[model samples]
Target: MRENEGGQERPGGEVEEPFGFWRGGGAHERVATGFEETPFGEVWERFLESVDTTNVGALTIGYWGADYDTHFVYPVPLLVEAAASFPNLRSIFLGDIEAGQSEISWINHGDITPLLEAFPALERLKVRGADGLVLEPVKHESLRVLRFESGGLPAGVVRAVAGSDLPKLADLGLWLGDEAYGGDSAVDDLAPILSGERLPSLRHLALDDSQFQDEIAEAVASAPVVARLATLSLAMGTLTDRGAEALLSGQPLTHLRKLDLSYHYLSEPMMARVCAALPGVEVDLDDQQEPDEGEFYVEVAE
Candidate 1:
C-alpha cells in the first residue's frame, strides 16, 4: 500500500511499488531459488551475487525450498541478509512456491520478526504458510499490505497482529485456518481488527480460510471497517446461506467495490440472493464447493 488510499503520491518521499499478485505489475526485481535442481548453499550464494540490492524496490522470492521441513532452513537467514542489504526494497513475498514445492497449507515457517525489524522501508509483505510461524506485535510505519495464506493460522500469530500498531496499514489479510493444524484463533480473539479499532487506516480486510467462516462473516457484516473498505474477501471457506444471509440483512455494503466469496459452499439460491443484493459490486462466487461426506469443508485444510 505504498500509494495513498486514493492513488496519490505516497508519503515519506516514496512512490507506490507493485506487490503480491501484482508483483511484476511495475518495475520489480524477481529472484527465484532452484531448490530441487541446486543445493541450498549454492542457491544462497547465487542470490547474494545477482541483485541490484541498493536500488531494488520490489522483490518476489520464488521457491525457497522443497517440502515441509526444508523450507524452514533456507529463506529466513537469506531474507535477514536481504533486509540489511536491500535498502530500497519496499515489498517482499516470501514462500511464493506452488503446491509441488510445498502446498500453501503444508509449508513450514519459522520466526519472521527479524525480517520485519531488518527492512525499515518495507511497505508491503505477503507470506505463505503458518505452521511454526512467529511474529512480534508490529510497530511498523511503512507496512500497509500484510497478508498470510495458510492452512492453519496460529492464535499467537493472530494475537500478535491484533496488538500490532501499524499506523499506515491499509490492507490486512489473515487466513485463520482450521484448528486441526493450529488455526486456533477464535472469533473473540479477533476483536481488534474485526472491531476495526486496531487498523484505523485499513481499507481492505480479508479474514479468511477458517472453520468459523460463518462466525467471522457475521462479525464482518457489522464491522466498522465495512463502511470504508474497497474490498472484502472471505474466500476459501465454508461460507453458506447463514453467512450470506447475514450480509444481505446487515448494514448496506453499498460502498464496497468488490466482495470476494470464492471457494464457498453456498447454495445456488443463496448465491443468487447475494448477487441480487449487491448488484453493482463485483461479487466473486467462483469455485463454489460441496460438502465432503455430508460435512461442510474448508478449502485449505491441511
Candidate 2:
C-alpha cells in the first residue's frame, strides 16, 4: 500500500486496511486503525502487537542468511522498543547477517542493553552471526537457554552472562568458530563461565566451531555445577580425539547421553575409543571431515 502524504512516498510504502474485518467505529477511525503512514516506530509497535497477542508464553524469532536486511532496516532504537514490549518472549535466534548495519556495525552492540534490562522473564537467547551482540545488563531470572555461534563470547558477554542471576538456566551453547583465528584462546577467555559455582542450574552444554584447546580442559573438566549436563556438542574445531577424550575423562559429564562431533577429523577407531571410554553415551561421528594431506601439516586419521 503506497501512501502519498503531500505527494511524498512513505518508507514502508502505504498501509491498506484489511477490508474484510468488521469495524464497530466510524470510517475515519476504522481506516485509522489499519491505514497509517507508519514511521519506523509505528512499524515496531505493530510488530510488538503482532507477537504479543494472546499473551503467549513463549515467542521465538529467527533471522538468517541474507534476510537480515529485511528485518533490520528499522533503526536500532525502534527495534529495541519492539523487543522490550514483548513481555512473554522467551527465545531469540539470530544467524548469518549479510549486511551488518543497525544500531552498531558490529554484532555485539550496546543497543540491546535496554531490552535485556526490561525483559525480566526472558528464557532463551540464541545469537549467531550477530557481529554486534555486545553485553547488556541482564535482569531476567527465568532465562534457561543460551547459545552463541560464529563468534567468540567476548569478555563482556561472558561477564554479563556469568553475572546474571538466572537460577533456572539449563542449556548453554557456545560456538566460537575455528581456532586458527584469534579464537584459539576463546575457551580460556570463558574461564568465568566455569569458574567458582556459576551457572548452577546449567545442565546441557553445546559447543560448535569453538576450539577448546588443552589449556582450558581443566576448567571444562572441573566445571562444578555442570554435573547434571545431559547433552554435549563439539562440532567443527581443532578438537583432537585427545581433547574429546580429555574432556570426558573422569569428568562430571557422566550424565551425557548425546555427543555430536560432526565436521571434526576423527577415525572410526579413535571415535570408537572415545565411545568406549564413555560407555552408554551415543557419539555422532558420521560427518567427520579433515583437511587435505597437502593442506594439513598434521597427520589426520581416516
Candidate 3:
C-alpha cells in the first residue's frame, strides 16, 4: 500500500497488519478488520494491539541476520515508541545479531533525550551500536539498568547518569571499541563514574572490550564506591599480567560474588597473579587450567 512519509494512508492496497509470532502467521488468529495500513505507525499500532496489560515486563527489538541492513535505516524510534504505548514496559533489549552485522556502522548522530521523554516507564535499557544519544537528560524513576554496546560515547555519559534519579538502578554496562582501549584510550576520563558521585546503587557492571587490556582493568578497578556491586565481567580482547593485577587489586567490591576473566590474553603468570590477588574468585570455564597453586578457590554462594 502507498503511504506518505508521515505514514498517513493514501489509497490503494489494504493496510498490512502486524503479524504476530506463531507457527502459521495469520492462520492462527482471526485477522482484525478495519485495520488500515497507515504506514509504519499503523503497523506499530497493530503491534501494540498485542499488548493487553497496562504494565509490561520488557520490550526488545533489533536487526536479526540480514534484517540489519535490509530493514529500517533506524529502528530505535519504533522500539521506543512501542515502549511508550505500553506504560507497563519495564526493560528493553535493543541489540543486533552480531554474528553477521558487526561490520555495520553504529554512529551517534543526535541527542536521545526525546526517547527518554517519550517513555517514562522505561526501566532497563540495552543498546548495542546505537549512536548519537544525548543521555544526560533522561530522568526515569523506574530506570535501573543501562547498557551500551559500541560506537563513540561522549566522555562522562555515566557521570551524567549519576546525576539522574535512577537510584534503583543496579547494573551498568559499557563497551568501547579498540580505538579507546589500553593506555592510549579514554579509560582515564571514566574516573567520574569510577570515583566520586558514582552510580552508588549499582550492583553489577560489565565492560566488553575489543582491544584495550591493562588500561581497561585499571580503569575498572578504580570505579567509584558502588556499595552494592557484586559482579564485574571484563571481556577484553587482550589481557596481560599487569591487567590481571589491575583488575584484582585495590577497589572495593567486598560483596563481589562473581568475576569473569577468561580471555586468552592472560598468560599463566597473569592467571596465577589473579588467583593470588582475588584469593577466591574462580577461573571462568573458558580459561585454561594449570597445576593447582592451592592459594585460592571459588564456590557459588549457597
Candidate 4:
C-alpha cells in the first residue's frame, strides 16, 4: 500500500507537525523530519539545535534520501546516540516515507532493537515498511503500544515480538502481508501471541493485511487470547465466507466491544449474519472487495 500523508496523529492525542530546519517560534509536542540531498546526520544535528527536544514527546522519521533503499543503516545509530536529548520522548514512528519517495515494500530498514534498548521508558512504537527489517527479542516494561505496517512483514520479526517480554503492553497490531515480498509467516508462528502467554495486559490486537486471512481467521476463532481482548481486528485481508463461518461457529465474541472486518471479501449474507450476531458490538464491514478472475486479494500487498 502507498502512504500519501504524514503522521497526523500520535499517541496520547498529540498533533504532529513537519520539522522546520529554520527554528520556529513555538515548540511542538510531536514533529516529523526527512531529508532529500543532505546527510541524515546533518539534518538530525540541525533538528537538535533548532528544536527544543526536551519538550518533544513524540517523533516521526520520514524519508532519508534518494538512496534510502541502499543506504539505510545510519538513522538508528543517530537516534540511539541522541536518546539523552529526548528525556520526555515516549512515542516514535519510523519509516514514515510515503509512496512518492518509496513504496512500502521498497523502504529499507535495519535492526530496530537498539531503539527499544536505548529508550527504556518509551511507550509507543509504530513502524512502516519491512524490507531488511530486524527486531530482536527484547524485554521492556514501559512499552504499551506496538504496531507494524508493511506489505510483507517477516516471520522473524513476528516471532521476536511474540517472544519478547512486555508485561505492560496493551495494544499490538501486525500486518502479516503477502509472501511475495517477505511475509512468510504461517499461522503456527502466531501461537504464542494467540495463546496470550507473553502479553498479559493486551486488550487490543490486530492481525491484518494477510494473504492467508482465512487460515488466520480460523485460528483466531478459538484462540484463548480472544476472551481477554476488548477489540480485535482482522481487517485489510482476503477474509471470505469460510473465515466468517469459522468465526460464527467458534467461541462467543460477545465480550468484545468492537470487531473490525473492513476491506474484506465476505458476502452480503455473511456480513448480515456477523452484524446480527454481534448486536451489541460495533462491527466495521466497510470496503467490501470482489474477486478478480476467481482470485481474492489482500488490500496492502505490493
Candidate 5:
C-alpha cells in the first residue's frame, strides 16, 4: 500500500513530499500566500533567499490572511536564524492555514520555545493555532514527533507536554479543545499524560479532538500508556455509549495493533461491541453521528 507524498499510506517508506520551503523526515513545505501585500520581514527575507536551507527537511508557514491580525508571522526568530542553515532538518509544521486562515479556533500562536531550543536536531513537531503557544520544561536530546493541532489546546500547552524531557518520544498528538477556544484543559489537566508519566517510547497515541471524550475513555482504559500502544487514536471525540463502555471495560486490549474509533457515537449494538472487542484489532468505527445537538458532538468545535 505504498502512497506517500501526503497521498499517505507509507506503511513502509521512501517518503519525501513537502515542496515549497522544503521538508525531510516527514516532509512538509508550503509557504506562499496573498503575501498580505508583502513585508512580513520581507516575506521571511524571500523565504530565506529561495530555500536550499542546505538540504531542507520540513517547513510550513502558510497563509497569514489579513496579515494575521497585524502582521503575525513571527517565525521564531526566522526559524532560529534558519536552523543554522538546515543541514537536513528534522521536522516542523506551523499553522498550515485552514478554516480559511482564521478559525482553527482563531490562529495566533507564539513563544515556541525559541524554535524548540533552536532546533537541536529536531525530530518532529507540528503546531497549529494554540494562541500564543509556549513551552518550558523541555529536555530534548533528539526529539521525536510531538504534535499539537489545536482548535483550542491550552492548559499551558497541556502542562508543557507534561513537563517535557522527551526521551525519544514516539508520536503523541493532542487537540483537546473547546473552553471557548483557549481550551482550558482540565480532566485535572491530563495528569501527566494520564499517568503514563509522559511518553515512554510511545508508539502512537492520538487523544484527538476532544470535549473530554468520555472522560478520555475512562482514563484511556486504565492507561499506563495503554500498555505501550501500537496505535490507539481516540479519533474526533465525543465518543458515546459511555465511551464505548469505558473502552470495553478495560484491561485486555489484546496489545492493540490499531483501534481508531473514528468520529464516534457507537450504537449498532455498541458498534458491534466495539468490533467484538478487537478481534485482532484494526477497528476504526467510522463516522456514525446520530443524536443531534443534545449529546454527540466532537468533530471539532468553534
Candidate 6:
C-alpha cells in the first residue's frame, strides 16, 4: 500500500495517468505521459505534437523506460527544453513509476534543479526515489508544495530543501525511510525546518516513513514549526507507544485541524489516548501495526 501506483493529488485536481498521448481532443489539464519500449525522445516529440502542452496545468512523468537508472536523467533536460510549451505548468510529479515497473528505492534519479530553474511559475513539485539524486538549495518564490516520495531519502537532499529559500512554500512532505537504503539523514539535519526559520508560509508538514520515527516524533513534539502547521503527519513509520506518549505530553495540539498518524505501531490504549486528547482535531489512526518480536520495520524500505 505504501508503494505508490496511481497518480497523486495536486492543488488543481487528481493527476490523470493516461496510457499514451491523446489522439484528438481529450482533457489535458492534469495528465501523465509515459512510454515503455520506445525511446523517450520520440515520446516527447509525439506528446508535443499531440497535445497542447501550454494548457496542461499539472504533469506527471511515469515509467520512462526499462533502464531507469540511466534513462531517469533524460527527463529534466527534455522538460527544460520544452519549457515554453508548458507555459501553464504549475505542478509536476517526477518518477511516477509504479512498483511493477521499478521498486521505489531502485528508481535512480538526477539533479532536478533545471526543472525548477526553467519553470519559475511552478507551484508544486513531487519527486519519487532518491538514488543518485542531487539538489542544490535554490530560492524559489512560487513553490507552495514540495514533496519527495522515497523508501530511502538522502540526507543531502533533506539539507538542500531545508537550506532553500521558499517564501511561499506551504506543504512539505519528506519520506525519510530506513538508513539501510541510503536514508542517512538524522534529526539534526532537520533543525532548520523544525525551527520554522526558512519556511514562513509552511502550514502542512509531513516527516513520515522513517526508521527513527520515535526520535522524529520526540523532536516534532516541541518543534517550533508544529505551532504553525494546520496538519501534521508522522505516519508510514514504526511509531510505537513511546512516540505517541511524546506527542501527548508535548505542547497542546488542540490548535491543529488534523493529525495524521496512520501506519503506526501504537498500543490500543495509546490510540485511545490520542483520540481523546484531540477531540476537535480529525486524527487519522488507520493502518495499525504490531512490532515483530522487539524489532520494528518501516512501511517502505527496499
lDDT of 6 by residue, 65-142 (tens): 544334433578889998998888877878877787678888767888888999999887888888778888989999
Q: How well does model 3 score by local distance difference test? A: 0.49
- TM-score ranking from best to worst? 4, 6, 1, 2, 3, 5
Flag the better candidate by TM-score, 2 or 5: 2
Best by TM-score: 4
Local distance difference test scores for all models: 0.77, 0.49, 0.49, 0.83, 0.72, 0.82
Kindly state the number of residue pairs that clash in model 1. 0
Residue range 39-130, candidate 2, lDDT tens digits: 33445456555543324444332222122333333233443555545445554443322232221123333345565565666665555443
Candidate that would win on lDDT: 4
Write the number of the candidate with greater lDDT, choosing between 2 and 6: 6
The list of candidate 5 runs beyond 4 A from truth reads: 1-41, 46-63, 66-93, 96-101, 105-120, 129-141, 150-167, 174-200, 210-225, 228-236, 252-295, 299-302
Q: For model 5, what is the alpha-carbon lDDT of residue 40?
A: 56
Residue range 1-302, candidate 3, lDDT tens digits: 10101211213853312111222111221211111223334444565677553544555543432223333334456555555446655555554324243332343224455666777766666665534445664557666667765533444454455456565666676654444321123655556555535455666666554345466677777656444456676653345566677766767544566676654356666666666665555445254423246221111000
> In candidate 5, which residue pairs get closer than 3 Å at backbone N, Cα or C atoms, i.e. clash?
23-57, 23-58, 24-57
| Number of clashing pairs per prediction, in order | 0, 15, 12, 0, 3, 0
- Give me the displacement of residue 263 in model 2, in angstroms: 2.4
Best of the two (5, 6) by TM-score: 6
Candidate closer to the true structure by TM-score (higher is better), 3 or 5: 3
- Model 5, 115-138: lDDT tens digits are 888887888777777776776668
- Residue 112 of model 1 has an lDDT of 88
- Candidate 2 vs. true structure, TM-score: 0.66
lDDT value, residue 159 of candidate 4:
95
How much RMSD separates candidate 3 from the native structure? 13.8
Q: Write model 4 residue lDDT over 166-243, tens digit each, in one string.
A: 999888999999999899899998999999989999988999999888898999999999999878999999999999
